[model samples]
Target: MTRLVGYTRQLAPELGPAADVEALTTAGAVRVFVDDETADPRRRPALTDCLAFLQPGDVLVVPSAVHLSHAVTHFATTVTALETRGVAFRSLTEPAFCTGDEHAVDPAQVLAAVEGLRRRLVSLRTRAGMASAAAAGKRPGRPTVMTPEKVAMAVELRNLDRPITHIARVLGVSANSVQRALAPLPRHPDSTS
Candidate 1:
């Protein structure tokens, strides 16, 4: 019997949604291992488990190619190891390809298609949200603690040779805040005091 293992990090939300579906569709057993470990690459518990359970002809399904490696070198090493074992892999949401066989679908191609579609959808949604915000007259970015008029007044006071400590006291804000607000503009000559 062909065994299909769907593995994903526990923290990855994408894995959770598709896990049940993969198990239902596949005839073989499915094993999920949380790959969250802060240790030497060889000492990772999940990696150890995957190696132990893996056999020739087993198909490992992951959420994304990136989930397999923390870095390019690590990914390459992982691919090599899996290849040596004759274990194949397929990604659910990323470049959809099955490993093995002469005419296998290129994983990179699938990944690129998935990524491009995702980016376009996200961009459209972001633009729509920004437009709605603008229509509502809600200022974008973080909420400002001080109004622009107050900021202008603060700048004017700083130009009149008031000490930062004194300006902060008048503005009812911290000296640190005064410094932050004026960071982009040139400092007033009178501010030396």
Candidate 2:
């Protein structure tokens, strides 16, 4: 017997993704799993449970292909593993990727390849821009949040035994940022390490 198991990480707290759940139910999902790990989707316990609950002959249905993995590039590898375990995949959005349909070849593979190509093109363009910036003696990527003046102030504040959190609040930055800035600061000879 083929069972459809749907999974989703995007949850609307107010209504709790009622529409997505209803759509999965309407699409014949025997069980629908929600991954509520907002801080880190990769560490979703529900996603792990969903995968563990799946068995051979079950179809893993998703609202979209993006729900399958943290990144589009990982979807192909994940779906390939599912296929290896005798499970199939279906997407509510991308109907072409549905397996067990009358098609000469698996469209999922093609879709995955196409997405990979798109990502590669983006990465190449970004790298080329960064290289050009480097050649012109301009640093690429995000500008430094902390400067020499900020570091000097941070060091002076630390010398006064000010807490990192307090200093961060004053500087309008995170404690972690402040900590990183002060990581290499040589302790005052009179202060305890």
Which number leads on TM-score? 2
Candidate 1 local lDDT, 36-139, one digit each (tens): 52334335677568767888988776665544554445555776688789887766554444466743666688576546545544554466567669879987
What's model 1's TM-score? 0.48
The per-residue C-alpha lDDT of model 2 at residue 52 equals 92
The residue-by-residue lDDT of candidate 2 on 1-193, one tens digit each, is 9999999866323435567778888999999998753526457787788889999999998886655666555676778888889888888876666666443456676676558545744564476567769889999877768888888888888888888888898888888889998898786677663
* Alpha-carbon RMSD of each model: 12.2, 13.8
What's each prediction's TM-score? 0.48, 0.53
Q: On a 0 to 1 TM-score scale, where does candidate 2 land against the true structure?
A: 0.53
The per-model lDDT (C-alpha) reads 0.63, 0.76
